[model samples]
Target: MINDDAQTRPLFNKIALIGVGLIGGSFALSLKKARAVEHVVGLDRHSTSLKAALQLGIIDSFTDDMASAIADADLIVIATPVAQTTKILSSIYPYLQSNTIVTDVGSTKADVVLAARTSLQEKVSQFIPAHPIAGREKNGPEAAIDDLYVGKKVVITLLAENADQSIELVAQAWRLCGAIIHHLSPKEHDQVFASVSHLPHLLAYALVDDIAAKPHADRLFQYAASGFRDFTRIAGSSPEMWRDISLANRTAILEELDSYSAKLQQLRASLEASDSVALEAIYSRAQTARVNWITAIEAAESQNKDGGD
Candidate 1:
């Protein structure tokens, strides 16, 4: 249901998308579907992606020129990899409007915040760091969907210099896209995601790589079951993106890796000693914890659904 009222008085007159990948294209489509933006301009190095976005009606126009893309745009979304944050911010800094509100969909926030601080300097407040906790094992503009963020968590990590108005406007933009907004400090965001998100992806990739390197790799894959597929589903994600994310949040990820390694060691010791009781105890505790977590999430989702009505 498109809101005609919102169309008549959209939140943003023009929004410039710096990358026409899954996140950027989805944002454009979602905003347009909600009638919360009058125009979306895509700016990406890859002409193919921009063309695809334009053809799909994700963006009203496409451009490779930074100045043309940012000029008069009320909001700018940097949807590139975390590795490109500094470069993108630096490129757009010269063309940013006084009232421009810049945000990103980067997976890691601390590095992005540092990049914004370095590139935007005195105007750093204009760039708010955000991480949308929604994605598939896919990439590119063609993979984008308008409802990708529906009911998903989008974390906004604020800078001390950010004004109240700017913060709310950014939050409202995500709200229009049907995202539930959450706030966290940059350090907190990175640390939390490093444990839960980054580590899982890393483990999945590692597991697949380990299996694929064996002489019986073909035989193993041939007989692989649903559990293998489910566990390694995220291993199919873009290597470039995950590489950048892992490097960007290496400090927190390394700490998490060490903690996880310690736990693995404990499990290995239990197995070596044939300690069935200890192994069963550990598995029981983990099962109980996961069940509680899932129950809490389901309850929250139900509450949110009821409230939405």
Candidate 2:
């Protein structure tokens, strides 16, 4: 349990956030709301994103120069797309301070961890790979919300000899934003998230693509409603971002995809055979699973509030 008094402690003297998109902007907003950092600086390649971040007052300052942005930061968050993480680490490696604690909001962990270990080993102890299981289908700064990570699960993948203080600081920062922190190794993190997160996104993309490829695609889309909209929502996410994540966690995602495909085929076969009993059983199981998941979420939320108090 986190000490409630510790919640008032300033986590970082200066925090540098790279890529002011949904995740980065949300972090800045949460930090300001909790007063977790004395200074927050946003860095992005896009001038428009930087300008909008400033206009939204998500950060105290903005810069395009990676080094200048992270120069004296006590905590640095790489919030760029997964594909850009390795390159960003290479660019920011030379400027990272000795005691600086660095983390990321990338969806995949194995590749991000590998990049940091290979290019920034000296800073590896401070590089804690993290992924917040919270986001909308929307992209960019305009889609960011202060409570984006609120009540979401944030997974932290720590290095073998990671500093305890750094891990604690990262956990505190997430908690301040109303997240439940969970610790996992890079391998376990990749596997679990691949099944739960990456696989779903892949299915969403595939489903929407399949529908869009139909001859009457435009006319079919006109009939889409709440169910179609909800299921295919993540298909609207940035293609570049999803592309990177797919490649980064390819192995685990493929395995899950195969399993999901087999299950889907079985259901399709049952439907074609008019096996109402099997279809009914499958729907019943899905409904029960959803109910249990909701109950678990409510329980966790209750616990988080109690712990915060």
Candidate 3:
């Protein structure tokens, strides 16, 4: 029999990571960082990815089969594309232990919660819909870093079916990964990210697409500076992933797109009329708002660090 101390020491005896890309890879490394889990078994269909993760010491073991990987895992993290969650969760449902806890690192949560509800039925209490508001344009196991979630905002979308213990464990795990937990309903999570995350990505893709369609586009891009690169960075993100997020949060994203379109039309009108005051007002307001946001975030981070110390 396992020692009582050993059983209680590990936050989880084994953590089964369903998708060993950036998020999932980072999660494994983070648990190791905090000494939270005794073992990690990572799953990815990519044989090369599994090998690389094992070589990098990101996982204790790796596998491609869904059911066998999660058979005895106490915690399951499904980090696949948002659109794949339903299918993946359904496939793994039969193998999950009744005491196992499930969570996802999807960008959107409303549909994820729905997927869990429909797939797990009465066992929905075992799943927690979570989104870590962090990532780069780069993905895959190679891009994973241990500190990626440090000081990041992790939103937990509270569901009616979620049990108190399940919620606490999910929240505590994120905290162990050095994230600050925030609670929201699935609807609220989707709406908030649709504006702040999805809308910006859509704008970036549109801007790049329009720029590329211009005559002598290559010449124009050759002269592009930091401002262009910074604004369009997200346009370089995975097309498959963004496509899923766009459709998954379609209603809220469409609302944001329409609002942005109106703003663009207003800016165009101001430029056409050569309204210097209006243009300056828009620029000044944007600059002020962004600077204020940065300042507030920095202050919060400092406060959190100080409090932790």
Candidate 4:
């Protein structure tokens, strides 16, 4: 299954991806595009997903058998939904090679780490909890694109028992797919994502649902402008996936919700008192801060490209 087009050898002999959904498929395709792996063997319980992955050439081969799929795999990516991650990892623990490096694309890291620690036990050293901060509202293999992770940030949660080689290998795989890596403790990763990612999705779903419940909902939606579209875009995300993330990171999410509620109360009081100056200042500061952040990010990206060249 090895295919090397140049002098450099492939980084992995085989990468066993346990899900054929957007994240897993995109990673497989990206690795294939980079010729970074000799073989990508996909495993999924869903027939449609496996079929689509095979037809689209996202994987070199696929299997429904857990043991067979991961036999001698140098790297294993557990890309199943957050809820199923623990069960999947536990099932594949015995099948993984001694040197196999295990990583995941789950949005929440604490629950995943707990699952690995409890299920994998001593073998947990091979498991490196990771979350690639990339993807779309869309789902399934058809929604996967090769460059979905390019230039995106991937956060890896380092565990106490993890081997240095395992961490390096997992990070190297993500680097091959053009991702910038960041490290955090599993707790820190969960808290950070709850504020920036999970809470927003919950807000979007609430906003969309609130509007849909109105009497003239259809008419209102039809007349909605880019503002509404932009704000509620993530409402179209996979409910199952978001639900798992919300619950898995419930503690941090609840804290964030409380903070947001307090902020909203202050904004509400400002509006009630007709404090136009306060409102204007808030909005103006947000605008400036966002623009500055964007400019800095773009400049850094340009610098990175120039440096790479």
lDDT to native, each model: 0.91, 0.86, 0.88, 0.88
Over 1-309, each residue of candidate 1 has an lDDT whose tens digit, in order, gives 123466378888899998988998898999898878988999988898888889999999987788988888989999988899999999988988778999999999999999999999999998888999999888999999999988889999999999888888889899988899999999999999999899999999999999999999999999999998999999999999999999999999999999999999999999999999999999999999999999999998788778666
Writing each residue's lDDT as its tens digit, candidate 4 over 195-232 gives 98899999999999999999999999999999988999
Error of 2 at 294 (Å): 2.1
Clashing pairs in 1: none
Q: Which pairs in model 2 have colliding backbones? A: none
TM-score of model number 2: 0.93
Q: What TM-score does each of the candidates earn? A: 0.97, 0.93, 0.95, 0.95
* Backbone collisions counted per model: 0, 0, 0, 0
Quote the positional error of residue 195 for candidate 4 in Å. Answer: 1.1
Output the better candidate (2/3) by TM-score.
3
Best by lDDT: 1
lDDT, candidate 3, 222-285, per-residue tens? 9999999999999999898999999999999999889989998999999999999999999999
* Runs off by more than 4 Å, candidate 3: 1-8
